[model samples]
Target: MKKMRERTRLIIQLAFAALTNGYVSGFLGQKLYKGKLKQFCLPGLNCYSCPGALGSCPIGALQAVAGDRSFSFSFYVMGCLVMLGALIGRLVCGFLCPFGLVQDLMYKIPVPKVLRKIPGDRYLRFLKYIILVLMVLVLPDRVTNIIGQGDPWFCKWICPSGTLLGGVPQVLSTPALQASLGFLFSWKMGILILVLALSSVNYRPFCKYLCPLGAIYGLCNPVSLYHLEVDKEKCTRCGACSRACGMGVDVPKAPNSPECIRCGKCASVCPHDALQFRFVHRKKEKHGQAENIEN
Candidate 1:
């Protein structure tokens, strides 16, 4: 039953992504409105340069601010993401992000190899923080040009999502863009290629170590309205949930750990039915109170 639910969730997520990208809307509307339906934006990290993309990407919006130096905070886009993350945590990453969904599907290619496990050092995970502070935020603004202009460092130098969905496709489709590719384009494209190749073996290297959006959303997970709980009384500590987790969360220890993407895989795999995916804002427990009060 749980497996069925998981598959259903996956299908629904994929369907939503497909429909919102204007793929379906564009195709259907072309018959009536002469390609006028290509003006919407989905809630996830979809490439604006994608032929099917109806709206701008959130990361791209952030990059525009960091890159322009003259721009202000993207209130509309940032508000949307914050509201979504606060409500769902990284459930968006696990279930909704198109790029994440693509990576998850790629890892299912059924190669005969052991799962790639990173060292379990809690500190090493801070690398994403460093990336966010330096690469995503600091570098772009610091490297200002003579005109006091900055560039979107991550989008120009790193972003695999842009490279895969925007850069590659646009370059392929438009001869003008292809002819203008410089050494930077090659460099970014190379990184994207490497990531795509590695994604087949590793689950989500982008989300784990690079994605600034993932980092931001992950911070909200520990206290987000939506969370996963393990009823310790029912849990046997069998580690089944942990073993089944794709995000490498120690389910028995901290099911709502920041590293958890709230994918529900662990909860679904729990045999004792001790795990639950529910909405709960975690609160401080009083010194001696055993009551599980909903705060």
Candidate 2:
């Protein structure tokens, strides 16, 4: 069952990568056969300016609205985030996000060193919130007067993913754009290099400490219907689950911890089969079956 779940996760991840990078990013280059289904933008860090993107990115959209002097909807971006939080929660970080896949692939490259400890200072995790405010909200608004409205501040200045997928490609493909390179291009390239270097040693430095989208999704994990559950009656409490958890979550104790990305690593490593990933009634049924067997 564990192996099966791993295989399924691998398939999903591969499909996500293909869709985001291969299909969506490369869609325009192909024949204009059909358009994408209409949906409110997802609350993630995907680049809206990327050629293949079918929908607007939340960060890009947020910056655009925040920078705009004329109109800004309080509900659009927040509502989209709330909806996604209520649905899949932090599963987006583990399964669906293309950037998460990039980080995962980077960690697999047999690097010299990798982050083993989860860090003693829990307060450091709050840095993402500060970044969300400064980069996404405050900085954009402050710079709007100087830089002009409709600028995607985060995308243009800081996002490594945007630099990788949109800026670099667009510049390389269009010689005219390359000629327009200035200090902004150099700064973005520097940010991308820093992120790339950090990703080699850190498990998911971006998701853990930088992604505002992950911060939002993580807040809902404790209450989401789709969450991890631990059967305490069956649990041996050997701490294997916690040790195995890559996201620094105490999985057996706090199965639906906000820090959990729902990568299934804890459930996959549990020796007693005490940890499970079932909905409410499914958990009840399993517990009842165990009772019946024991009786």
Q: Identify the leading candidate in terms of TM-score.
A: 1
Q: Name the weakest run of 10 consecutive residues (lDDT summed) in model 2.
A: 30-39
- lDDT tens readout by residue for model 1, 156-190: 77788888776776677668877899998989879
Q: With candidate 2 superimposed using the best TM-score fit, by how many Å does residue 180's alpha carbon deviate from the native?
A: 1.7
Would you estimate the TM-scores of all the predictions? Answer: 0.85, 0.83
* Superposed Cα deviation of residue 256, candidate 2 (Å): 2.1
CA shift of 141, model 2, Å:
3.9
Candidate 1 TM-score, C-alpha based = 0.85
lDDT of 1: 0.72
Q: Count the backbone clashes (under 3 Å) in each candidate.
A: 3, 2
RMSD of 1: 4.0
